[model samples]
Target: MRAPSGGNGGNAARLWPGIGGLAALVALWWLATGAGQAEGLAARFAPSATLASAAGLLRHPDLWLHLGVSLRRVLLGLAIALLAGVPLGLLVGGVRAVDAAVSPAFQFLRMISPLSWMPVVVMVLGVGDRPVLFLLAFAGLWPILLNTAAGVRQLDPRWILLARSLAATRAELLMRVVLPGVVGSVLTGLRLSIGIVWIVLVPAEMLGVNAGLGYFILDTRDRLAYSELLATVLVIGLLGFALDTLARWLHRWWVPS
Candidate 1:
């Protein structure tokens, strides 16, 4: 008899774990929400109620607006980070003296919590999309900057040597060689940056933005819509997962297997 192909089996093996985990989570959720188990405020956010609330929200147009606003903020912040971080990273990673000078400050700022700057950011920017963008950009910038620099530093010395031998100008070398070589690293940074941006986004939205997931979360709480609040939480998790998956897909597409 011919040996069976492992392709189908391998796929099944990979899929089963994720399915099993989700099943287990649902089972646990039900158990928690069982009569006499989840009481008081928690009871309001029981799985069944939360699912119903989510379904209701899905029927409304406003939910999409909130989601869109949040997504727009994420994109804008990521754009700013990419624009700023790539150049900085290239400078730091390329030149030893620049890296030495900037690394300390980068590390210090990176260690400080993004939310910790909320008071000052709001005070200066004064409660709007701009502040939110600043926070997300700040949160996202480090990963991109560090990764880009690492990518530059890790480039094979031969690549530059070959370019120089060919009389490639600075701009030409960067465009043809350096950029392509570092794309994978930049994508990796972008993946990390997106996750950081998303985490910051929710709280940032809560900072007086009239719309977005974080604002809706607070509104739900104030309205005593615990089920809706839980539903929003679920939506946020799903969106984050989707965003990360997209970033991974882009990385895979841009980089060879």
Candidate 2:
């Protein structure tokens, strides 16, 4: 226990550098925006009046609605990805012929950037939440699929043999043995997928949703409300970080190290 505490202390110490780096970035941003450091640059490429402009926008009557809308869409996309990705991955990883036949195409499509699919999705779905959800789910699916397949492939052969020896049926072996064994990898994939979804969401929201952080960003820019825009950007980043952290905690608690 003492050794584990010492190890944790070491990790905490290492984490300080990242905190320092973030502080340095904020300082740089402040200086650049202030009159002293980048006055000429600010004149050419202004940081906008966000720090001052932030309050009214933050206090805007509709702020929560916009944020809530985006959050709902993101969660919807995430759920769809988890449901679709895990099963498809299991199919791909469990059978050799299926993996060989389908993996190449999936890989090819996954390599395509999410933004590239935007136009097609919009045209096909004709705008609204459905299109946005599709893009988010598409962006988020690859990680879970690839990771789950890898996990399935890397499973211990002995576990399978033991299951066989115990007179377990094929269905029982898969349900009790295989699923749990690959859960760690599935969580890892979900973490990666969450990150991807968060990143893609902003642009996806620009597709004419009446609400959402993405649309809020556009509104701030159009309204020239820099502070609110800055605040929205900060909120976007924080939300993404929160989602990733939640996934990490889930992985740490629910899955074995």
Candidate 3:
């Protein structure tokens, strides 16, 4: 039989380590739960129970509803961030005067935790999806804004000069030259923003939203459904993983070598 190629061997070498590590972690988790003993909270929420709960949840209609609500909130928040951040980033990055004026305040506000604004947000937007959206948008905005601004700053000055030399109008310059140059940075920001938005979505959903993953988690805990709670956590992890993978694929597609 012919030996496997070096490329295939190398790929297997890299892949197996990750698979092994994950397997080790799962083994440790199961062992730590005393191998499915019926005693203790750890045992009650063992990996097997969690997996079973997750399987059961797949059959539950309410799970889909919560997932849908959470997905909607995340997407809406990201949309709001994109609409606001891109323009603001363009203004801040393209104009030195605007950058100097806004930089200090923007940095300061960005450092403050989005959760700190929860009370104020709730008061301003009141209960329901609006407040959750505000928080998620707030969480997502800074990364997008900063990355876009950085992209703008990194753009080749020659491109702008060439456009200007051609007597391109300001609108044409922005549309044809500036926007394309910054698209990679904008996508990077978007990837980061999605992760932030997903993280914030759960806590934001805890506010007044009747339907969302966060609400389901709370409901599960209240009803003493520990296994279901673990299942929810697993679901969150899986969904976040899938979203990040999609973002990465999009980035690669947009900025191919």
User: Using TM-score as the measure, which candidate wins?
Assistant: 1
Ranking by lDDT: 1, 3, 2
Tell me each candidate's RMSD, in Å, in order: 2.0, 2.8, 2.8
**C-alpha positional error of residue 135 in candidate 3 after TM-score superposition, expressed in Å:** 0.2
Candidate 3, pairs of clashing residues = none
Task: For candidate 1, list the clashing residue pairs, or say none.
Answer: none
Q: What does the lDDT read for residue 43 in candidate 3? A: 68
Off by over 4 Å in 1: 1-9, 35-40
**Candidate 3: deviation at residue 68, Å?**
0.3
* Whole-model alpha-carbon lDDT for candidate 2: 0.85
Instruction: Give lDDT for model 1.
Output: 0.93
Name the runs in model 2 displaced over 4 angstroms: 1-12, 34-58
Model 3 over residues 80-105: C-alpha lDDT tens digits?
Answer: 99999999999999999999999999
lDDT of each: 0.93, 0.85, 0.93
Q: Backbone clashes per model, in order? A: 0, 1, 0
Worst 10 residues of 1 by lDDT: 33-42
RMSD of 1: 2.0
lDDT of 1 by residue, 1-257 (tens): 99887988988999999999998998888787774377777778788788999999999898999999999999999999999999999999889999999899999999998999999999999988999999999999999999999999999999999999999999999999998988999999999999999999999898878999999999999998899999999999999999999999999999958
